[model samples]
Target: MEAFTLSSDFGYVVLVVVATVFLLQWLGIQVVMARKKYEVSYPRMYSDNDDRFNCVQRAHQNTLEVYPTYLILQIFGGLYAPKLGALCGLIWLAGRVAYALGYYTGDPEKRNRGAFGYIGLLTLLVCTVMFGLSLLGFI
Candidate 1:
C-alpha cells in the first residue's frame, strides 16, 4: 500500500470547498438583502412580521447548521477518493442552491427541492467509512 500524502488530485476537493464557501457567502448576502428589504433590524434572527424575510433567513441559517458536517465529511472522504468527493460536494452545493431558492419563495415545503443532496451526503458518509477501513487495513 502507498503511504498517504496530500496530492494534486485533492485540488478538485479544494475547489469544491471553495465553491461551498462562496455559496455560503452568497446565501448570507441574500439574507442581508432580505433583511434590508423587510426591515428586520440587526440582532434579530428572524422577522416576526414578514414571512418572506424569515424564509430567506432560514435558508441561510439551515445551511450554516449543516456546513460543519459537510466539510468534515468531504475533507475526510476526499482523502480516499478526491474526485468522487468533489463530485458529491458539487451535487450537494447544487442541492443547497435549489433549497435556498425554494425557501426564498416563502413556502417551507418547497425546500424539499433540495432533497437530492442526501445522495451526496450518503456517498460522502460511505467514502469516509471506506477511508477509515482502509486506514485500519480492514478493507
Candidate 2:
C-alpha cells in the first residue's frame, strides 16, 4: 500500500481542532475562576451556596459530556467534506461560547442561547453518515 499523507484540504479541520483545545482550556479556566469566586473547594464539583458557580460548572461539564462524540464526528466528517466540517465545528464552538456566557449570567434559562449549536452537530452527524455510506459503496 502507498504511504498515506495528510493533504492540505484537511488544514481547516486541523485548525478547528486546535481552536477547540484552546476553547476547552478557556472553559476550564472559567470553571476554576468560578470556584475561587464562590469559595467552592476542589473536591466539590458544584457550589451549594452559589447557583451561579453551579451554572458555570455545569456549562463546562455538559460540554465535556458531549466532547468525545463531537471530536469523532468532526474528524470523520471532515474526511468527507473538510471545509464544511470545519465550518460546522466553528459553529459548534461559537455555540458553546454563547452557552457558557449565558450560563455565566446566573440564569439557567439563558443557556438556550446556545441551542443553535445543535444545528452544527446535526450537520456533522449527516456528514459522518454520508462518509460511512460512501465507504460502503452506497454513495
Candidate 3:
C-alpha cells in the first residue's frame, strides 16, 4: 500500500483553492443566516431580511449536500490525475458560486442556472469513481 502524499499537481492546488473558497462562502452565508434568524431588524419590503436568511440557509444545505461527494471524488480521482481532478473541481466550484449568488438574490431563473454547478460536481465524482475502479481493476 502506498502512503497518501499531500503534494498534488498544480491543477489540484487550484481545485483545492476553489473548493476552499466555496466552503468559506457557504460558511459565511450560514453565519449571516444564523445572526438574522436570532435578531430582528427594521421593516423593509424587498429586504424582508428573512428571505435572504432563508436563501442562505438553503445554500448552506445545498453545499452540505454536495460537498461530501465532491470530496470523495476529488481525493480518489486526484490520486490518478490531480490536474484533471483540479480542473473538474474548478468548474464545480464556479458553478456553486454562481448558484449561490443567484439563489441569494431570490431569482428562480438564476437558481436554475446554478444547478449546472451540481452537475459539474457530479461529473467530477463520476470521473473520480471511474478512475478508482479502473485502478482497482473493478471496471
Candidate 4:
C-alpha cells in the first residue's frame, strides 16, 4: 500500500483554500439549520418564511449540487497543473462564497457570477483529464 502525496505545485494551495471554503459554507448552513431544527420540530424546521433562512437554504442546496463536480475537477486538475488548478479552485471557492453572501443578502444576480466561476474550474478539470488520458495512452 502506498500513500498519495499531491504534486509539489501551487495548485495544492488552491485545493486547500477551496476545501476550506466548502467546509465553511457547509458548516454555516448546518449550524443555522440545526439551530432552527432544535428550536422547532424537524418537519417544520425549515418552514420559516424569513428571507435569510430561505437564502441560506438555497445557498446550501446550490453548494450540494455543485460541490461534487467541483471536487472531481479539483483533484484531476491538481494532478496535471497543481498550481494552476489550485488557483482556479480557489477562485471558484471565492465565487461560491460571494454567491452565498449575495444570496443571503437577497441579491439574486450575484449567484450568476458565482455560476460563471465554475467555467474556469471545469476547463481546468477537462485539461487535466485529457492530460491524464494522454499520459496513459488512452487518448
List TM-score per model, in order: 0.96, 0.95, 0.69, 0.71
Q: Per-residue lDDT tens digits of candidate 2, residues 50-103?
A: 899999999999999999999999998898889999999999999999999999
Q: Which is better, 1 or 3, measured by TM-score?
A: 1
Rank the candidate models, highest TM-score first.
1, 2, 4, 3
Write candidate 3's Cα lDDT for 1-139 as tens digits. 7655555484564558566665767666554655566453434213344566556556666777778777777667666667777776777777777777777675546666666666656666777778778767798
Clash-forming residue pairs, model 1: none
Q: Model 1 TM-score?
A: 0.96
TM-score, model 3 to reference: 0.69
Which has the better lDDT: candidate 3, or candidate 4?
Answer: 4
Clashing pairs in 3: none
- For model 3, how big is the CA root-mean-square deviation? 5.1
| lDDT ranking from best candidate downward | 1, 2, 4, 3
lDDT per residue (tens digit) for residues 30-93 in model 1: 9889989999998999888999999999999999999999999999999889999999999999
Query: Who wins the TM-score comparison?
Result: 1
For model 4, which pairs clash? 10-83, 11-82, 11-83
lDDT against true structure, model 1 = 0.94
The backbone clash count of each candidate, in order, is 0, 0, 0, 3
